[model samples]
Target: MLIGCSPSYDTSQAQQVEASNKQTLAQAESSLPHKAVVYQVFTRLYGNTNTTNKPWGTIDENGVGKFSDFTDIALKDIKSLGVTHVWYTGVPHHAVINDYTQIGISNDDPDVVKGRAGSPYAVKDYYNVNPDLADNPANRLAEFESLIARTHQNGMKVLIDIVPNHVARNYQSLSAPEGVEDFGFSDDNTVEYAKNNDFYYVIGQDFSVPDAINGYQALGGEAHPLSDGQFKESPAKWTGNGSRLAKPDANDWYETVKINYGVKPDGSYDFPRLPAGFEHKSAAEHYQFWQQQDAKDIPNSWRKFEHIAQYWLAKGVDGFRYDMAEMVPVEFWSYLNSHIKHAKTDAFLLAEVYNPNLYRAYIQQGKMDYLYDKVDLYDTLKAIIHDKKSTAQIAVDQAKVADIEAHMLHFLENHDEQRINSPDFAGTPEAALPAMVVSTLISRSPTLVYFGQDVGEPARENGGFGQATRTSIFDYVGVPAHQRWMNNGKFDGGQSTEQEKALRDYYQRLLNLSHSAPALKGEYQELDTYQRKQNVVGYDNKVFAFSRFSEQQKMLVISNFDQHNGKQFSLTLPQSLLKAWQFNHTETQYMHDVLSQIQVVYPIETQADGTAKLEITLAPLQSMVMVL
Candidate 1:
């Protein structure tokens, strides 16, 4: 309708326009799922109200203990923390000898060896529930059902552990039939015993048989000696010029064998060759037979473990915490997710992918609903407390919070890492409050709290596994009186130091706030930091001073990252948009005009340049939030 005119822009203006567009797109992509919380549990050490001296049952090297002795008072206590999901660690059957008992492992010493129970990663059997975990192995379904039901009733979900990588050493699956000589296929004309060609990825340089004439030295008969493959200076050498033998892709790994991915000549992988006693058959027939009977395919291998997962879901479990998820094929996880969702629409899937690269792949595939975002948590915590970074840097770091919230599983500590209260940070009790606050409040995804974290427990060396950081809280051999040191603050002269009390109270308040405030509940936006001081960091948005805001609830959150005394600074508050607001401090109601200017004071240092600096504070770091 108007006169035909060609619109044109200056070169600089066009470039600026394009840059703005790209920034907007990037921001949109980063701001995804806004709310979630995760809680971590060491199932073995959590509690065992029913069992005695066997909290983890056979898995406990020091014998079993009562679940009631756990540091957590009750499931209700966990619920009070406002976590959305709970991840249990190591819930699989493992090898008794290889994983739990070995040289330097003593049966009498609790610190060195408690019993022959094994690490859950050993994975003795996938289909059967560990008998030690339940009084009646056949009734495992009932026990698991009750646990899931209780967890849901407490307003939370449960996720068990799963390992799908390598199987246990000395597993029964690889054993040859009784009295059968030359059981596998023969190759290279070396057929005195079973042919090695039938073994998956087994080659001349991969393994070595025991030379009976050489005192079985090549066979590793001493139980602790190096394997024959390890002694070879060629392809199997573990170090020196032949260090390539230790490569993860190597065809052999101790007794744990590798699987062949390439198709066999007969277009099958199950049956590569028939035994000397069996009649020769077509490759297809061998494949069919192996598929039906091979241990790697008998519903327990990495490819077939989904059936066991289905069984657990039917038993009322809601989800799983996949162990060593990085080692398994992504295709398997995709398959598992499809099957699990079909069975339970609300099923949760949390993968223990510690690496950022692997986690990104899983997130892109959507195979995992959540993953442990350790790197982000670690970096953010350091930036906030340790580094005392500038407000602008914190703002940049906080910008990633939205991305983390979308797919990350936040946690303060887990069994795999050192305890948060360890001396590495601040051994004093004061450190607990600040750690808990950051873990629970600042995170975008679900937050996890390890067992024994509520009450301080020192990390100790694992008995059989050398230098393990995690330790059990339940002391069986000693009387409750002797263990009084662990539970000091419960009564008088207990271990609940003043710092511990402050931390607990602080945690309780923060959790209550998270539950009560919609602004703090979900979705965080990184606002511009106007004052980029060393100690004081400030951010504001239209509705809130910080990036955290809730439009529907009409709430805004402003946090002070200053470590020391009060700081005087100015912020360009969006007055036109924030009309008639109330400041959230001590739950008080104040007119917006009455609090246009405010000052925050902490027990840290301050510079005249309006920068906030924190003091050499102990544990329970200081932080404050203002809500409008």
Candidate 2:
């Protein structure tokens, strides 16, 4: 889940639009493809070929990628990797290092900005795409729409960031459509919270710069009109990272100011409350709930976001990845998402909500399609890869969230996480093979893979505010490995090493398998439980096993997490479990490996007590899927 640290979840395959105007969730999903593979790439860094990674480099020192970089060939290459959707991060017109004054955009005060290319979450405008990404700044919105059209032509959907919890400290909407009002444009700013106001302010306090610039300077100490150590906010609002200080702590989300969603300083709701059974209500009912209310009664902030979402939908955006979703009130989500679906049914709504206690409310009432399974699955998998967790515990963890598994999007790497080959992480890309296997095939949920993850980008550069473990989301930095695959804009791996090629090939095979395989569609049983019941000796903590079956296909997956190579073991499947699938020594069957294409005949040795023990062998940190 997108913590206040870094947040997001991802998408589903773009489905055919329903013929009928009104449809159920079941109907919308049925027409859509079965599984989703989300490819999340930071838009500004995706095509940058620069290798000069200075610590606090300006845009010139380290080049930035443009919207035009996603050529038809580049997108086709991405689609060929079995991706269903492309999440283009940092697309919105956020605070950045630029002068758009002639185009009606104002300069952002650098004292509050995080990096030269500022945080994407600190959005500066609601109705525009980033001018930094356009070849022609005046036509940026058209360029973005063209990118969306190109993505659709290549059969993939688009998802962009929508930070509802906050906006840039310098919030000014230069291009809002006619009749749309800017946030705080009509506010009664005297009080901390008003039903109609968009921001919560600390009256009588002029905003002061945080004490710790930490020797950091805007534009690397180059002077500019607005880059001086001063900003113009009187009666300061709460900082985006939840700091209430007039001069927020340097560590706070200092670049942005928090939006008020009708919640008072004393933690009381100022907006209309949902009824006790509202979460159980359908979207139509939720929409009708708003329809019944007077326009004046609906909170302005709620309506403002509704207008923002509808504007993007009109521009052909499929859905939004809401940042820091849990920070906003759940009722507002109920309000905002209901209106979003009303505009475009099957709009993919993914949120970064960390509280498991709030999961059901967020999903049921907020009408969210997916949330990040970070705190549970991703964290556990990371621990297992680092030898901090036992593979034996994988089955227990899966069983705990069996009911909500489909709604939890699975991933090992995203913007917030450490790269697999980074020194702080596992320090090797191959170490994630077993973990990736389980993450992609754990359930019927969507799976997300960060760009360059397959080829092992170590992200070793010191990119400004964030650390090296994560590819810096805050700086203008080039990813070393991905740039090799980019191969001077050919969108080919012509310059990649043999190991990098092998890793990408593995990912392609795995992702394509996840999208097509039949056994994965339904009926899961952990073989680890069977091993425990049999008191199996060779099946140790470093090894894990499971089965996925439907009427036609039955598949078994096993992984060995040991450090040393070639650890052979016997994984005993109880006679009862085998009989359930109609397997016997009487019929000799070959078990086919899905990824390797190597086949092995079943060594189904029948026990005197009427059970069968299957012989299985695996390499260190390797995973295999054998078809029955």
Off by over 4 Å in 1: 1-36, 48-61, 65-73, 97-117, 135-142, 170-200, 204-303, 355-360, 383-394, 398-404, 460-469, 472-498, 533-545, 554-620
Model 1 lDDT per residue over 1-628, tens place: 1011122546686567556644653464345333445567655444432223333233343443222332233556666656666765555544443222332211221111112344555454554444344444445435555666777777777777766554443223212234322211222223211213322332335333222332322212323323223322112221111122323322223323222222232333332222321111222333344444545432223234556677667656678887667654443454456556666766778887767656644643334767876675655554454434443444454455454454576665676666655665435434444445545555445566665555554454333222334453222211122123235223221645565555555555665565455555444543344323212233211111343555533333334433343333334333322332222223323212111123533232223442322222211134444443
- The model with the greatest TM-score is 2
| TM-score result, candidate 2 | 0.92
lDDT, residue 359, candidate 1 = 61
Q: On a 0 to 100 scale, what is the lDDT of residue 444 in model 2? A: 74
RMSD of each: 13.2, 5.8
Clashes (candidate 1): 32
Q: Least accurate stretch of 10 residues (summed lDDT) in model 2?
A: 2-11
